[model samples]
Target: MVNAPAEQKKLPSWWSGGSVVYQIYPASFKDDDGDGYGDLRGIINKLGHIKSLGVDAIWICPHYKSPRVDEGYDISDTDIHEPFGTREDCQELIDAVHAHGMKIMFDLVVNHCSDQHAWFKESRSSKTNPKRDWFYWKPPRMIDGVRHPPNNWRSCFGGSVWEWDEHTQEYYLHYFCSEQPDLNWENPETRQAIYNDAIRYWLDRGVDGFRIDTVNMYSKYLDFPDAKVVAPETPWQPAGDFFSNGPRLQEFLREMRKEAFSKYDCFTIGELPNTPSLEKILSYISTDAEALDCTILFDLADLDHRGGQYPLMGRNWALSQFKALTAFAQQLAEPEHKAHALTYLENHDQARSVTRYASDAPEHRLTSSKLLATYLLTLSGSVIIYEGQEIGMINAPKDWDIDTEYLDVNTINTWREIKHDAKVQNDPSLLERGRAGIQLTARDHARTPMQWDGSKNAGFSSNPDAKPWYRVMESYAEGLNVGAQEDDPNSTLNFYRQLVSLRKAHKDLFILGRFQLLDPGNDQTMLFTKTALDGSQVAFVALNFSAEKQPFELPIELTARQSQLLISTLGKSSESRELDAYEARVYLA
Candidate 1:
C-alpha cells in the first residue's frame, strides 16, 4: 500500500467533478527522439500542451512491453517497453504530469497478456507445471477422427476464441487474437499476481490512476458453454453471453479494490463494454459500490452501429436515438447515485467521432466538430477528448489502400473475410460496399499519427525521412495540424479550449448539476439543461444535429431578456433561437 505523502495529500482522487481527461494514444501522439513512434519522453515534452488544454488528467494507452499483436494490449510484461523508453522514463512521465498540475492514468490491460509473457510461457510448457492453471488451458473434444475446440466461442478479431497448443495437445482461450491469451482470473494466485505485480506496481510508481482495459471480462462463465448463435455464417459465435459481466465480476472488483486500489491514493476508470443497462453501470461506479471509480461507457458510441465495436457493421442513428441515450446517461449524475460519469466520443479502439457522429465533409466539418465538442463538454460528466479530436481529425481517405495503410488486426481480419465472402458469393458490389464500410469504421482512422505541422511526417517525428508507424491524414498537413489551429481563434482546437475554460468557470452547473434532457423526441434539434443541485445555476444548451438550418423554440416560456448568452459555435450570441446548420449554443438561463 502506497500512502500519499504529506506533500501530495490531495493525490487520493483528482478525477471527479468537472475533470476532463486528455487521452493520449502514445504511439501516435508525438515522437521526441526522432524514432517515429511516440513514447513516454514525447509525452513528457507535451506536458505543457496538456496543461494548457484545461484538463485535469491524462489517460495514456498501453506502453508496456508487448509483441505488438494487438497494438500493445497484448502485454508481455509489466515493464515499460524499450520502444516507449525505460522504466525511469515512465516514472519521469508520472512526475512530469504532476509537476504540470495534471494527473496521469496508465492504461492497465489485465484482461490478457501476450503469448510470449513469462507466465504464459511457463503455463504452456507442461501440464504439470505450477503455472499450468495460470491461463485457461482446456482439453480438446474429439469429434470423428479430429480434435475440436471446447466450444463455439468467437474471438473479438473474428474466429474461434480457442487456439490449439501442439505440444500440450490442448487449447487455450483467447477472447482477442491467439497471440493474446486470457489470464485465468478464476485462480486466486493469478488475481493476486495481477494486483500485486501490475496494479500496485504502477500505483507505487506514483501514477495518479489507471484506465483499466476490458475490466468486465476478468471473470468468465465456468461452464464455457457454446455461445448463442448470433451470426450463423460461421460456427464460432461471440461469447459475450458467457463472459461479459460474469457472475463473479463484482466479487473480483471488490477484491481488487481491497487488495490494491483502496490502499493507494488513486482512481480507476474501467473499460466496461457490453453493459446490460444503466442499472448495471450504477452497480459498478456508485459511491457505495467497491468497484470502479468510473467506466468507459459505450451507449453513445454504439448508437451508429448494430454490432458493438465491430467494423463494417453500420447503422443509421436517429437524432432521437442519440438524445435518448444521452438522457439515459444523465441518470448517473443524480445526487442519489453519486456516480462520476466518464464520457467520451473517440478513443484508440474506435474510429474518429466527427466522421461517425457528425458531418465530416469539408463544408460542414468545422461547424460540426464544434457542435460535437459542445455536446461532449456540456454533458454532466468528466469528458475524455481523444488525440487529434480537438483539431477535427476524420476517417482515413477512401483512396487510401486498406491492405497497406490500415493496420488494425480487427480491420485486417474483417477485410480479408469480407473479400473472401464477396468472391465466393460473386458480388463485386459486395466487396466495394465492404471496403467502404470498413474504411468508414476502421480503427486505423484513430490510429493515425498526430499531425503537428505541415512537415513531411506531419511533424510527428524529427526526421522527415523517418516514416511514422501509421499513416498521417495527408489532408490535415496544411490547415488542420495543431500548429495551424493553435493560431486560429475560431479553429476547433481553440473552440475546445474555450469550452474547457467555460466548463471550469461553471463547474457547479456542469459537474454537480441535475441534467434534464428536453425535446428528446426532436429528430433535428437536441436541447438539454443542467441545473445546479442547490438551484443556484442553470445552463441551457441547444444543438442542431443536421446540416440544414433548423427552427427550435424553448419549451420553457423564456426570451432573450431572461437569459445570458455564454458561448456559441457560430461565434455570436443572437436574440433568435433558430439554430443554423450544425450550430451549438449554451445560455445561462
Candidate 2:
C-alpha cells in the first residue's frame, strides 16, 4: 500500500468543492466575558480546536438579534448580531475561522421573525398599517359574534396558527410560536427587504456562505388549505404538510441564489425539509453555477423506527435502516453530484447521533464514533459534523429537566400541552412518555454547555455562581472535557486529530477523490474507498455495526500488496483483519 504523504498539503481547492462542515451551537461552545452563553469570542478562541478536527468549515447557529423565543431562530433583524456581540465581533469571528483555514457558514432563519421585531409590531398595530401585508394577516371570522381564527391551521408549537389582534380585529399566522410570526413571502416587499439585508450582513462580515434555515417553509400556499390531520395519539400535525414544501419555495430560493448568494464564491447549504427530489437537490447545490453549494438532507433523520402506525418511525437504531438510507443518499451524491448532498447524521434538532446510533455503550462509544465518522466522511458529498461528535459525547441522561423559567418557548409549550392533554385524558403514562420523548428530542441536551472540564459548571461560565443557558452533560464530571482529552493520546480527541491529519496528508485521495461504496447491501457493516483521479488511492473506510464480529469482503479488486491501518478505534489492525465489535478502521490502500 502507498504511504500517506508526510507533509501537510495546501488547503484543498475542493474544500469549497465539498468537505467537512462542523455545526456549532452558539450557547454551548464557550462563554466569553462570563455571559453564561457562548459568544463570537468563544468561537474565536476555539478556532484552533476546530481546525484541529480537520473540518473545512463551520455552520454557526443563529447569533442574530432575537428575543430567544426559539433560541435565536426567531429573527428580529437579519442585519444585526444579537447581544452575543456586535457586527464587528462577527466579522472578527469570520476572520478567525478563515485564519484557521476553515470557512464559516452563518445560519439564516428566514421563515419567521420575533413578534418584538419592529416589522411585526407595526403590522399588528393596525389593519390599515401600510406594512400590514408584510405578514400573513386576515380579518378574524366572526362566528356567533365571537372572533375566531381565520383558518384551521395549527402552529407547530401546538396551538392555533392565527393569533387575534384586538387592535385590528385581525389574526396573523405563525407556523412556529405565536411570538414568531410567519413572514408573507407572497409579498415582494417583504422578500426583498429580508434578502437585501441578510445577504449584505454576512457577505460584508466575510462569511463564506450560509446554511439557510427552514428553507422549504419560506414560501407558503396562498390558499392555506387545511392539512390532513394526524391522529391525536401522535404528536404529528398535518398542518405542517400544507406549508412545508410550498409551491413558491423554489422560486424564493432561486431569487435568493440570484440576488445574494450567486454573486460571490460562497457556499450555501439549504436545511431543507422532507427528502427533496434529486432534480431539486441538484438544482439547489449543483456546481453548474446558479445554485447553493449543497443541501442537508433529512434521510437519516427520517430513519427512526416507526411504531407501525405512524407515518415515520418512532425511535430504533437499526443498522439496516442506516445502511439503506446512506446508500440512497450516496447514490444521489456519487462522483457526479459529490458536492450536492451534505452528509450528516444529526443536527441541533435531532437526537445526538453517537448516543442514538452507536448505542452509547461505554466500551463501544469510541468504536461507534469512528464507525460513524468513517461512514460519513468517506461518502461523496459535503459532510457536517455535529458539535461534540468528535469526542464521542453521548446523549445526556434522562434525569435532567428544563425548569419552566429556563425553557425556550417552543419546548416549554410542548411540555405544557403534552402534560395538559395527558391530564385531561387521565393518562399519566402519556405525560411520562412525553417527558421521555422530550428528553430525547430536546435541542437543549446538545446545546448544553460544552464539556470543557470537570470544574463546577464545566468551566463554561466564568462565574461559578452564574447559570449557563442550558445544563452541562454529566460526562464533564466523569472526565470527558477537552482539557482532559487533550492530554490523552488514546482519547477520542486525538483519534479525531489523527483522522484529520490523514485526510489532510492525502488531500488528493481524501478531499478531491471519487468515492465508491463497496457494498451497499450489507446491513451489519459499511465499506467505501476514495480514489483520486491520478490513480492514487489513499484510504479504505470500514465499519462494523453488528454486536458480534461479522465477516465481510471488499467489492473492489485491490492490487496493493498490503494495507496499513492508519487509524482505528479497536486499537489494533492489520492489512487483513477482522473488525471488533462496533470497530471502525481507516486503512491506507
Candidate 3:
C-alpha cells in the first residue's frame, strides 16, 4: 500500500495510512482560558480525552488569524488567531499532541486569503503595484446601462464572487465571501510564497502534516468565462466546473510536494469537493502519484441535499445510491489502485449524523449512532470522528432565533436570503421551510459548543456566566455529555471506544483485507465482508440503516462458515427480530 514514507514506516501503527483521526472544531471544543471561546490551551487540556478514543492523530480546524468572517478559513495572516492563542500556544499544542503519542494536522487554506491580508492590501492598493497580479482583479463589464461582475460566478457563501472595489475601480474574485479573495496560482512568485510561508512554516514548527483546505481549487483558468445559467432568478450561478481541478492542478501539487511535503516525514489529507470522477479522485492517492497521501471526498456527505447545502432542499436519499458512492470510495483499497481513503458520517461542515443519517428520536438515538460508528470503523480505510459525535449529539432545536443564536456566516446569509424571498413572493412558506430545514443543512448545527458535562455551560466554559461563541446543546444536561457516558458501559461513547479496539485488534483484516460489498440491491441493510488476502479468514458485517427491524441472510460465500460474533451495536439482542432496529453486527469466521 502507498501508506507511508520510509521514515514514517518505522513509526507505530497509527502513523500508517490506516490510523484513526479525530477532528476538533477548536472554537467550540473547550474554553480553558475562560474567554467565552475555545482556544489552544483547551485542546492541550483535552489531549488525554482524545487519546482515550484511540485516535492516531487530531485535525484541529483553522485557528489562523482572521476576521472570523468565514470562521478562520479566510486567513488574514498565517499566525495563530489571538482569540485562540499565540504561536507559542500552537507549539505547545504540537508538543502536547506528540507527547500523547498522536500527530497534529493543520488546516491549510491556500485557495484564498482575507481581503485585509498584507498581500491583498498591496495587490489592491494600485493597479501598477508589484503584487497586483497575485490575486484575481478584473474590469467590470457593462450590462445594458449598469456595471456588472465580469462573469456569473457565485460565491460559495452567497451572491457574486466578484466584489466591487470602489477605491480601485475594479473587481476582485472571491470564491467564498467577498472578504476572502482567491489567490493567483499562475504566478510562480505566489506559489513560491505560499510554499515558503504557509507550507514550510508549519512543517518547520514540528507539526506532523496538514489537512489542505479545498486542495483541488488552487488553480483556475485566467480567461474568466461566464457560467451556465442554472438559476435565472439568482444574480450569480454555480461555476464550480470553471474553477475546480484546473489544468495546472497536478503540476502545482507536484511542485508543492517536491518543495515541502517530500522533505518531511508527514501525513496529509486533502479536502476535495465538487469532484465526481472516481478515476480523477484516485489519481491523487494512487501508488505512483507524487502528491497527497490521502484525500476526503464529499460524495456521500451531500447525498440527501438537492443543491449543495441549500436550505429546505433536503430529500430522501436512496440506499442504493449511498451504497454505490460508498463502494466507489472503497475502490482505493484495490490492488490495482493501491490507495487509501478516510471514512466518516460527520464532519465540521454538516449536521450531526445522529439526526441527519439516522433517527434521533429517544428510542433509536443510541443504537443508530452505534450503527453509524460500526459502519465507519469496520471499513478498510482510516476513520475520522468529529467532536461530540462519539456521544450521539444531535441538531439543536429549530425554534432558536436565527439572528441571535445561529451566528454562522452561511446560516445568517441563508436566513436573510430566504426571509427576503418569502416576503417578496408574499408566501410565508419560504421562511417556514428555512426553519424546518435548519437541522438539515445549516452549518451552525456543526458549530455548536461541545458538551463535556452536565454542569454550567456544559463544562465547555469554566465560568458559569460566560456566553460562549455558540449556544451549547441543552440536551447535555440530560445525560448526553461525555461525563455521563464516560462510565456508562452501554453508552455510545463506550461503544465507539470498543469498536476502535475491535478494529485495531484485527488491523490486518480490517485495514488490508479485500472489501467485498455484498447485497448491493438491499435497500435497508448494508452487508459486506472483509476477506483476508491470504484467504485464511473473513469478517462479515451487517448494518441496519433504518429504524425498523430488518431480516437478512448471509450471502452464500459466508453462509456455511462458522463464525464468532466480534461486535454488535445492540448488544446480545433479546428481540425475536434477526436484526433489531439500527442493529449492526460483525462476525469473524
Better of 1 and 3 by TM-score: 1
- State the lDDT of candidate 3 residue by residue for 1-589, as single tens digits: 0123344322332355488889999999999888889999999999999999998899989998999999999899988899899988999899888889888888889999999899999999999999999998999999798999999887777788899999899999988888999999989999999999997888777777888999999878778788888877677787878868888888888788878787677787887787888788876766577777788888788787646435335767878788888888887776678677778888888888888877888899889889899988988878889999999888887667778888778777777777877798788976787776765777788889899998998999877789998888788987789999999999999998998988888987887778888889888988988887788889988889887878877666566787677787868733233788889998888
What lDDT does model 1 reach?
Answer: 0.84
lDDT of 3 at 574: 39
Better of 2 and 3 by TM-score: 3
lDDT of 1 at 226: 89
CA lDDT, every prediction?
0.84, 0.71, 0.83
Cα distance off (Å), candidate 2, residue 201? 2.7
- Give the alpha carbon lDDT tens digit for every residue of 1-589 in model 2: 1112223322233346557888998878888868687788888888888887877889899888887878888888764455477777877787777778877888887788899889998988887788889898887778899776776766766677888878877788888888888888988898888877876556655777788877778877788765555555543444655767777777787778777765555677777666447766665556563556667777677566322222222465666667767656665555566445567877777767776676677777767777777666656656788778777777778666545422656567667776777888898986776676666555555676788777888788767667887767788766567877888877777777776666667766665666666667777877777777677665677788867886655444344536566777767655565777888877776
Q: Give the TM-score of candidate 2.
A: 0.89
> Which is the winner by lDDT between candidate 1 and candidate 2?
1
Give the winner by lDDT.
1
Stretches of model 3 off by over 4 angstroms after superposition? 1-14, 306-312, 573-577
Write down the worst ten-residue block by lDDT for model 1. 1-10
